[model samples]
Target: MPDNFGRYFVNAIVAGLVGRIIGVVKTEYERAKVETAAKLKGIGIGVGLLVAAAAIGFFLLGVLITAAILGLATVWPAWLAALTVGGAMLLIILILAGIGASMIKKNKDLTPQQSIDNIKAALPLVD
Candidate 1:
């Protein structure tokens, strides 16, 4: 009778531990799902912005080219206006590119790295 009781006691303990583990895994899975969804949403927004920026950039290039041509025909010599406009546009593009690079650098981690590490740490115990 004591042997049977001991076996049952160990079985209960094992079952409880398994249940707790399953609960933790479920919670973590849900959290990871939510994080992945948010990351995808952010990526979509970033791509949309990039497309919009490219469209605006093309429009600006057209306007600037028109301005350069007008300036060359009316106000300044051809070479001088072309050089000035080209240099200014190049500098502005470089500045804007730098700003965009910095912004991307600051928030580049799209993965839930902290959660991943936490799960890795917990995995041994689960095993």
Candidate 2:
């Protein structure tokens, strides 16, 4: 009877350990899911910024072309006016693109690396 009790005790301990491991994994998985969602959201914002930059560039260039030509043509040559407006528009685009690129690079990690490391640490045979 003592041997039987000892066997059952060991089994209970192993079972409990397995259950705890499963619980940790489940919790980490959910955390990873939330992190992925946030990363995706950031990516979307970065893309939106890039698209807005292009759209604004084109719209402003088109709208300002006539005004710049009329306003600056009196002071400078028509060609020079157009050139100035084009350069300014290009500069605007570059600045916005740089900001958007930085954002994209920042959120580029879609995988939950920290969670993965935690899970790896918890599982001994997962190496």
Candidate 3:
């Protein structure tokens, strides 16, 4: 009976140790997941900004081309046509800025800290 009790106690201790190790592993995995998600979100934001800037640049370029064509067709001074195109470009920039601001305001919920906390809470460690 004494030997059996000792063996059972040893088994219980080993089981508890295994459970603790598993909990640590799960916590670490959750942390890694949160970090990766944050990094991906940042990358997505960078790509979006780059694309938006490129689109705006292309739009301005088109406006300039159109102005040049108009100046040649109507015999207007090239300098005045260029100035008008510049003003139009400025107006487009302001409109884009307003759109960007509104979009940022709407997407304010996915903050970095909140994302981390939400992931941590979702991944509860088992003992």
Candidate 4:
């Protein structure tokens, strides 16, 4: 009977240790998943912001073109010249925007995940 009791006690102890190990592994996996998700979200947000900026730049160019055309039709001769100049300025802006977009696209290292990781690493060190 004493031998049987000892065996049962050892089994219980092993079972408890296994359960704790499983619990710890599950917790670590969950933490890693959360961190990965946050990094992805940050990358998505950065891409979205850059795209939005490009979109706004394009929309402004369209508006400027429409105004330039309308002004050339309705305004006096002097104003028509000014409107043409404004159109030229709009063309320059569009060219600059294209260059800016190209630069942004070429920048491979500036990702949202990198930003998120930097912020996370910095925060722990700050306090």
In terms of lDDT, which candidate is strongest? 2
Query: How accurate locally is residue 118 in candidate 1, as Cα lDDT from 0 to 100?
Result: 61
RMSD of 2: 3.2
For candidate 3, the 10 contiguous residues with the lowest summed lDDT are: 118-127
lDDT of 3: 0.66
Candidate 4 structure quality by residue, lDDT tens digits, 1-127:
9999999999999998778656655665566667656655555655665566566657666666766777777867655665566566666656655655555454444344543454455445422
Q: What is the lDDT of candidate 1?
A: 0.67
RMSD of each: 4.1, 3.2, 6.7, 9.1
Best by TM-score: 2
| Residue-by-residue lDDT tens digits, candidate 1, 1-127 | 9999999999999999888777767777877778877766655555555555566567668756876777767866664666566667656655655555555554466676656666667667632
lDDT of every model, 2 decimals: 0.67, 0.84, 0.66, 0.61
Task: List, in order, the clash count of every candidate structure.
Answer: 0, 0, 0, 0
Worst 10 residues of 4 by lDDT: 106-115
> What does candidate 2's lDDT look like per residue over 23-117, in tens digits?
98998999899889888888888898899888978876775677676766576566566667677877888888888888899999899987898
Off by over 4 Å in 2: 63-88
Candidate 1 lowest-lDDT run of ten: 98-107
